[model samples]
Target: MIRFICCLILLSISTLVSAEEKLLHADFRHRPPEMIVENNRAAGPLKDVLDEAADVIGYKIEWRIAPFARSLKGLKNGKVDLVPRVIKTSQREKFIDFLGPIGHRQKDIVFLVRKGKEKTINDYHDLYKFEIGIKRDTAYFTKFDADQALHKILLLDDRNMSSMFAAHRFDVMVVLDKDSIESAFKQKDFTDYAYADYKHKQNIGIFYGLSKLSANTKVNAELSRILLDMSQSGRVAQIYQNYKLEAPLRLF
Candidate 1:
């Protein structure tokens, strides 16, 4: 009886340790190639590399889905622990700590229009002609984001973007990744769509934005160091390679 009681005590201690395991919260909204959701779990290059880094640093991740704005707000107020694919904006840098750039800022941003409407959106000035579908609380670029004259429909993160386009919900879709839109286009048999020709070739990158208020802040240097080492060791590139994407070269 005493041996059985001791065994129960050991089991209880193990369960307690498991329950106390440290977990960092991260925002997960599906953006393909860079960030993807497969079978209700986060996948893709960004999540992969981050996952590896966190595991090495003895941490687990708890992913939550929220609107882009709310995600940023969570980062600012310490509700969220990390946000991937974030550009370093002046206002955001004040509250969030960027690990480093993973991919070029303009490398993926694209504006898509329905067949025959591509010619109508050849330049930024022509955006005023119709309403555009834009994700809420997303930053595309400085001038475009700050423009108040354009008519934009604020879209939620969970909405069906392809179905909305098929239904003609808006005239344009500003996407962060070309592969995501292309995959959606192929899946919906909506291959007739074309890109709007306003060229934005900014070579800066988006980053892994860590929250200032989270316990993860304590391991900021260690995490950043591991990430830098990963980037240099080609592990970051290898992760991107699994998704058939190119890893950014300039990480500093």
Candidate 2:
């Protein structure tokens, strides 16, 4: 009877351990100052927020690096449980449930033009006169995306975009704020690019999305609570500061 009781206790302990081990799969594409994966480990301000939230919620994260389209498809197919950074859209909402802004309060989509040309692009209409470079599979803003009149050159990534812009292949490259443009130019040793502030005016929130197919209301609630706490406590700002980025605007 003593041996039987011992066996039952061990079984209970094993079951509890197994139950507590929840494995989550997250997919992302390379986007600097936000999400960057090196040798299978994710880094950057956005990633840091996700890591802290996962730790608080007690989940083992399995990170996968893929193109933006592939990652979005994985989420819809239930192959990926999470995507660290995504701009909320109606089409995407059909496949995923968005959580928090995750990193900062707002993010901007700006036009990166050669320094001397900044004065030429005073409005969206002014952009029509220039050849614009856009990252493949990225959504800037609804109007910009729908504008068929603007000649757009689609590039594979930021590095390519910057290189082509330097080569005079494009007159303007649509880019995220400093995090992306600064990193891309620094990588290519191109320093003559400047933001055309008057041309693009879209400032939107970024979010972490959970796959609708793999929905877990309990986990979502817990993650939201933890992220909110982190934002309020300045933990989120601290992460950005570590990267030498200005503290993100706070909506909370």
* Cα deviation of 161, candidate 1, in Å: 3.8
Q: Model 1 TM-score? A: 0.83
* Model 1 vs truth, CA RMSD: 3.1
Minimal lDDT window, size 10, model 2: 101-110
Instruction: List the lowest-lDDT window of 10 residues for candidate 1.
Output: 100-109
Best by lDDT: 1
RMSD of 2: 4.0
**Which pairs, if any, clash in model 2?**
none
Which ranges of candidate 1 are over 4 A from the true structure?
1-20, 65-70, 102-108
The candidate scoring highest on TM-score is 1
What lDDT does the true structure give each of the candidates? 0.78, 0.77
Model 2 agreement with the true structure over 1-252: per-residue lDDT tens digits: 999999999999999999998777888766775677678776788777887798888887777787777877877887888887787888778888888865444456777887887777777788888888997767778888888998999887766777788899978888754676578778777789787857555556667888888745457778877877887789988988999977667765
